[model samples]
Each structure stands twice: as structure tokens, then as C-alpha cells.
Target: MALPYGFVKAKIVSTPQLKSTRRPHEVQYHLHFGITVNGAPWDIAVNVGTTDADDLLKYQLVFDFRHSVLTTLKSTSPGSTDLTGTDALPALDFLRSDFLAKTGAWRNSDVMDGSDQVEPVASLQRLLLRAQQSSLDVYVFGRFYSEGDGVHDVHMNQGSRGEFIHHAGDDSNDHNDIWQDGALLVDLGEPEWALYAAAFDQQYVPTDDLGNPAPGSQPIS
Candidate 1:
């Protein structure tokens, strides 16, 4: 199916900024670009920061799809009443060690526990190893839409996730931005369903190794 109105030709416009600080340890920032179906500009921003022992960073992004009439229609009124549990899309999550293992970049060392919901430590180990070897750039894209039997049906999927590392002092723009580009198309299971377009960018610190800081080690700066 064709992508929603505003997202048809979306594009990513900037590189992310990475900052090493004593307060937060690590901070990353970036942005994305697109135009709504009505031709209004769509801009999204993301920020992420992390401390030493965490395998994940605190992440946040601003998404503005208000100009998307189709999204507004589907998210409100009689259209929303038709949705069912099955119509809800899966949640999009950050990449973790388990995901890396599944992708053949590493091996799983810990038993799978459903309650943890966090990525395995092995993945963080691999990521830190890579980071130490060279600066790494990672990108992620998220697309949300509706399809099948319900009008308010929602679905989410990742376009791609990958890493590119550069030598330590290369200064070749090692920083990475995750808000590349994305598109969404809602079928609403009917011809009358409106079309919406959404484009967003996310900037966040990469997950660090999951362990306590080394004794006497200073924070990043």
C-alpha cells in the first residue's frame, strides 16, 4: 500500500550530537524532517542520556502529527470505537543484547526471563567492546499504522537497525542519528479510511555496558 500523505517523501536532515559529561555521563541529540499531507512542516527531536552501569539510556522524542487529518480521524470519534485488542500493534523497543544475538553479532550467556524486559548483558558487553575499539553509530526507524478488520487498528515496525564504527580519534563524524526516515499507511479495512503521514527523529545516548563503574573511575567528560 502507498504510504500516508505526509510521510510519502520524508527525509532525515541532521546528524546527532554526542556529549560526554560528568553530570549525565553521556548525552545525544538529533532531529528529523517531513511534510504533512496538508504541506505543513513536520519536525521531531529526540534526546538521550545515560550513566555507566545501565544497558539503556533515558530517551525522549517530540512527535507532531497534528496536521495529519487522517491520524486525527482515526485516533478520535466513531472510528476509534471500532478498534479491538487484536488491532493494537506491537510495541517498538530499543535494540538489546538478545536482539544482537539473534542477529548473529553475539551469543546469549544468560537464561531468558520474560519479566526482565531488558536486553541481555551480553549485548551491552558486545556494544561496549565495539565502542572501545571504535566509535559506533546506530540508527533506528519506527513506523506506525493501522490495517486489517478494525478502523482504529494500530501496528508498529522497525525499518532497520545497524552500527558503523570509526577509529577513536578519526574525527570523521562518528556521531550517529536514529531518526532517519519513516512512513505509515493505515488501511482501516475500508476504502473510506483516511490517509495520514508522520515523520519523526530521535536522538539518544547509546546504551553503555551494564555494570558498576570501576573503582575510582571518573565520569565521562
Candidate 2:
């Protein structure tokens, strides 16, 4: 089974940092942003596309994610909350829920044009910066650390394949689960909240209840 899937309701406390711990020829890049949950330091790790001239799997980005879950999230307490059981907290499911609209809504190309052609990193940074400037609370939907002070996998957690599919000796994808998708939502005040979501290029939509890709599954183009 996957780790405890949940969300962290907090406020941005510091500027975002672009960090990479991968070795040469490896493409593991993340945007590490800082937030304070109930006066404690917490990290938000968001995956981004690589600028390296490699043919690794690129990441897909989506902004302005809309869902009724935001209404419930706004009422949650400040700190880490486990959304594992049947509760009022709405769990995110990228393929099963209406978190996003049509397939074309996914942005995998240039987010900006001309001189302002910023990568996913810069675009996410600007979003966080705006939230910080507005002093809004950030609701991070993902798996909370079981041993540390942070939340990772803030992206689409379904339709996983290959190495991402956790093998439990019997080749079963233990990591696959419904209603545990990850995303980030910033409360931009009444009727206006900015959301940030991402997914790997290899991941496909129309996942099954087990979170596995169903027949005719297609990637967001």
C-alpha cells in the first residue's frame, strides 16, 4: 500500500528553492518550497521538467485547478491532516474526479511567450510568490512524511507504470490507489483560488479503481 495520503494546510514562510540531488545522467529535479504549519517548518516538494538535454520523461503542468474540494479544504485546521479514512475531507483523484476539465487543459508546452518564457520552475515560483505576497494559506494535497517534516509527491499519483509501480514480489502495484492524488491549492480569497497540479508524461488518464491505467487510457497532450 502507499503511504498515508493527506494534505497540509499552511502558509508560505520563505522563498522557493530549486534543488536537485540527482547524480550525472539522472533527471530528478524538484522545487522545494518552505511553509509553516502551526509554527513548524515544513517542506513542499513539487516535481518539474528537466532543462537538461536528455530524453527523460517530461512533466505536465496545470494551473487554476477547480474542484468543490477547495470549499472543504478552506475549513480544515492548520497543520498536517491524514485523509486516509472515510471523512469529510475530499480526497483528490485526478482521473476519477472532476479536478480538471478536458485533456487539452493540461499544459505541457511553453507556459509563457517571448522574453517571459519561464519554465515550470519559474512559473511555480511566481505562483508561490503571489500567494506569499497575498498572505494566503496554501493547501497542499499529498502524502505526509511518515518520519520527517515535509510532504512530497505533490502531483498525480495515479496511472503509474514501470518503476513507479511498486512491486510487492507478486508484481502488484502497491502504490496505486484511488482518491489519493496530490496537488497544491492557494487560497486567493473568496471565489478565487489558484491551484497547481502536475503529472509525468508517462502517466495516463482514465485509471481504474486500483489507480492503474484503464483501456484506452491516454496522456494529457
Candidate 3:
């Protein structure tokens, strides 16, 4: 199934939920949401877990939307992109923090929930709390259904080489052709804001979209 690239400006319609499946063979963590837009209803989820692609890289980035965070984001991701969610954002186009500082891992010292389960949702509540002040600009790739409705793959879309994820090529003929990037932007107030971007390292080009590749797509072998 191919999910197109998209970005939506929306507000939280209800309380978000975090669910994790830790069965050895089916291990993964999910954060789901009920999103409210002026004209449409949307369902979005962020999916990340373990795989043999290279190493375990599950993480969540949260920002406080302070003046300092805003300055960094603007200086880093100054480029304006279409919300179609079809673009790949290079590191220069976004903020890149130290692993320990950005990771929401309990072992990594992230602020954890009271449950403190193995796969915990740290910093999630902290960030969503900020959204209470205003609508969030969510970047996503939506899949429209036959009934003119749909859900969104509201997470990082590139870098997974698994054939199951359609990461190998851009042949539209193939149903598995949805490779993209997404993020959440918060407008704290005039000049203060933040962006939460998730991504994987296995991608050849984080900024490449369908029929387009980032300025550099070659690798050194």
C-alpha cells in the first residue's frame, strides 16, 4: 500500500494513547491520536521498534518550544517545504541533537511515566502538553480509502530497507512505494517554537521524494 506525503495543521480531539507490543516476534511501540481539522477527521500513529536493518534505533524527540529551541529550528530547518509529506529532510534542514539528549529511552535518562514499563512513552506527554496552547502542524502521508476517508503514516517514512516497507525503489507500479519524512511543529508564540522530527539512518537520502532525490544520493563504497 502506498501512502502519499502530506502535512496537516490540526488540534488534538481527545487524549492520545501509547501502546506497545513486546512479543518477541511482534515487538513494536505505537502512539496513536485522534486529530481534529476544520474540515476533516484524521487518524495518525507513530510506529517504531526493532529490526535487523542495522541496529535498534527507537527514539522520540521532544522540544519545550522555548526561545532557544525556536532559534535553533529556524537556523537549522529554514527551508520551507510543501506539506504533501513527499520531501526528505536532510540533517541540515532539521535539528540534530546528541543521542542521549534527544532519546526518550528510560535507560537514557528520559523523563519516564509512573508505570515505567520496558517500552515506555517518555517525553510524549511533556510535548503534547505544549500542544494544549495551540494547534500543531503535523506532517504526514495520508492513505485515502474508497469511501473518501483515511488514516496517516505520521512518522518517519524513509530508511527502512525491508521489502515489506517499499524502501528499495521509487517504481510507482509497485504498491509499496511510500517513502517519506514527517515532523510535528509547535507554535509557542511569535518567535518561539519547536519541531519534533523522527528518522532512520539506513536511508541513502533523507531528503529524497518520489521522482526527486536530495542534492546527494550516491554512497561511498
User: lDDT for every model?
Assistant: 0.24, 0.68, 0.42
**Model 1 vs. true fold: TM:** 0.22
Q: Provide the RMSD of all predictions against the true structure, rounded to 1 decimal.
A: 19.4, 4.2, 7.9
Tens digit of per-residue lDDT, candidate 1, span 13-96? 223222233434333222222223223433322212223333233212112212223443344322112111121221112232
lDDT of 1: 0.24
TM-scores of the models, in the order given = 0.22, 0.80, 0.54
Which scores higher on lDDT, 1 or 2? Answer: 2
Best prediction by TM-score: 2
Expressed as tens digits, the lDDT of each residue in 1-221 for candidate 3 is: 34444444556655656655564443445466666555566565654333333433334454443323334344433122233333233211222223224434322222223232333254654555557435554433333322434343344444344442354444343222333344566665565455554443344443333322345653211
Worst 10 residues of 1 by lDDT: 149-158
Deviation from truth (RMSD, Å), model 2: 4.2
For model 2, the local distance difference test gives 0.68
Which portions of model 1 show Cα errors greater than 4 Å? 1-9, 13-28, 31-37, 46-221
TM-score of 3: 0.54
TM-score ranking from best candidate downward: 2, 3, 1
Model 2, residue 83: distance off in Å is: 0.9
